[model samples]
Target: MARSTAMKAAGLILALLIFTFFSLAASSSNNQIQILNAERRIDLSSHIVKVFLTLKVENVGTSPASEIFLAFPPSQADQLALVKAQAAIGKKKKKSYVHLDVNPTQLPDAPNGTKYFSISLLNPLSSGETATLEVLYILTHSLEPFPTEISQLESQLVYFRDSALILSPYHIKQQTTFIKTPSTKVESFTRVEPTKFAGRELKYGPYEDRPPYSFSPVIVHLENNSPFAVVEELLREVEISHWGNLQITEHYKLVHAGARHKGVFSRVDYQSRASVKGASSFKHLLASLPPRVHSVYYRDEIGNISSSHLRTDYRKSELEIEPRYPLFGGWKATFVIGYGLPLEDFLFESPDGKRYLNFSFGCPLAQTVVNKLTIKVVLPEGSKDPSAAVPYPVEQHLETKYSYLDVVGRTVLVLEKKNVVPEHITPFQVYYTFKPIFMLAEPLMLASVYFLFFMACVAYLQIDISIRK
Candidate 1:
């Protein structure tokens, strides 16, 4: 009994020592990095909030540092959709930016549950070395509609909340922030010292000697009438065939995520007073599709929608669709768009004799956000060991789908993602192994049915009718 008790005490002491060492190490690493200058640009010209940050960082630590951390408040972190970073190389005019890997990380001692995303440097920065970083991040659902509900004639006004100071884990020597609104009509803004407003731009700070985790809150109220289109759910189905064509169908639950519309909506007033009324509403949406797309169609539960147009060329295809009625705030529309492509364009066989279907992922609509995106790739029957290659992480699972002339059912690869933006529309591949003989299954089945019917008719004719005899 005494021996066991002693062992337990020793284990507790070791665990405490380990925790203390790591805590101190983290503190020391954060203290060794400092910002010489920082410039932040906020673009509020659209409902989506975009922030560009230019940082000049210097390593003051004795040891080499390989990573830099970006800080954001807990409230803003949930709204963040994208984070990207680049490092500037060379001097002045000759400088070029190289993409760097940035990923979210957790800190045990973070105050207020601050979120951190670490940028990995290409080369470690030795003591006294400096580097320049260019970062861009996007946030959705960050703008708050002031009135929440507005009349058709009233213009949209939103409130944007952010900090005038750069949020970082390292101390900053100086920082400045610039905000650009969509229109020159600014209702009000919180002013820090040295704040300036010129036209549609608001400038704040050039503050000096700020400590780590510093924040000075500011709010700006301005006019922005850009379409706030959000897809509540999107289901994309890509069906591949070994014959000659590949088909894609997308179902969407779309909504206008701007200020809610109140009072009775008058079609005549909305049409006649278009210039100054219903500024935040939208009627049309454009989708960018792959080149040489054919047989494109858009329809809803009411059948084919006529207010849409498709333009195609060798370079690209564009489809502009209009909802049955104009989409106002808090309004939703559901529809499906489908098209076909030549099989040669996407399906290819590798040297190892493995077949893969290369296709684009995410919502094809321009400048829209997808709350939940689900992609289903239906591989040809007799497929073995199907896999999906996506650039980012997605929830993946396999399902069986039965279609025409299918015996064992087709393999479907389902990929699910949330909080997707237009930038997520990149190429993904689905690979599987298939035998050529499987392509003949449908034709052979048809042939057998025809032959059996012919034999039955011939036998019936030869037998004749017993009553007539």
Candidate 2:
């Protein structure tokens, strides 16, 4: 039979080339798993703030890979559900993934795969698999120390992570040196590892898996008279204008995280160290302004900043700013602030009517040597089909006819980012597409140049005598 139909068409082309090489090795092993590594640690002496995610799966199939899923974006799952509900109410117990809410179809029942509870994996992950997951959270008003400290004036404290506070009975006792026996060499509470509180609360450690760049070297000589301000760095900008206005800018760089005063700084030993109330070298910083912002300014870079102090409320529109030297302990400062508002309080009018604008700003985490930072956004003269996006890497430029008078110059959007930290200031966004004939080409080119100079002064009064001369 003609050689068995040519050997059954060569065995159906070798079984379609072995099913296209196992479908490209199962799509390159699901694109080599992913995530690889992620970290966020803020311990500050057991106040607790840890987020570490590392994943990598590569099997190259032969048969042996089970399951894998990792996805967290809703503001990093609400900062890991407020650090697992402040470490389960400071460990009174009741931690079922502590108030879980990590969306995305709740990722196939997370347990060891942690999809954020609501039906964890009973068990089953065997193949050519590779796994590793670790999640620990605890936030509850991180730490504080502003009960009392006078020395040279300046004190204030309040930093929350998984917060709680209620201290008031005085008789303080938590020192290390400066005379107070029972020595353990005060290596800062022997590198922390204590918990359980009440009567002015004091708890530390639910201690599970402790190993993400471990830290323990404490220091708390309370009765802090106040003043150890540490801003490190801060830059804020909110710009939006569709003619209705809304601009608020702030730039600050401050330091003085305390502890280190050997010599040189003795105004009569700081006026007798502020009369023995002791523990002072200045630190007072505060900010809270938002109410249809108005013309409020504070400058630096060699200008304005006469030790700053402003309080406003032009009828229910509040503002309170205070700053002008008093941030001692390795002192350093920088400033800039501005305000103006009314862009319909951050534009939004859709339903097919188009027009949207949103903004957020504030970043300063111990001055991480910012190499560069630039942001220039001006839209609404004739906003084209623009869609600006920046989560870090950006470079775009386009220009045409730009001139100002009644205005015709608009559509300038420039964004540049580098090094950036401080949690990337709320995912920047800028989109456009507003063209009303570029606002009538600058008022019709200034009324056609004043009607061609009034027809050249009525044709120069009917020119004639000029030739006879």
Query: Who wins the TM-score comparison?
Result: 1
Residue-level lDDT tens digits of model 2 in 1-469: 9999989988998887877776565344334433222223333332122333222333334554443333332323433322211111222364333332222334322223322322122233244443333333432222343332222343333233221110101111121111121112122222244443233323444343332113333333322223444444444455555667877676766655444343355556555654342244543444545455667777788777654454556443333344564444456777787777788866665566556665543242221223334455556566676565564445666543353563545665656554343344554556676655665776688898999898988888787766565
lDDT of all the models against the reference?
0.92, 0.43
Candidate that scores best on lDDT: 1
Model 2's TM-score against the true structure: 0.35
lDDT of 1 at 169: 86
Q: Candidate 1 — which pairs collide?
A: none
- Cα shift from native, residue 373, model 1 (Å): 0.5
TM-score of each: 0.97, 0.35
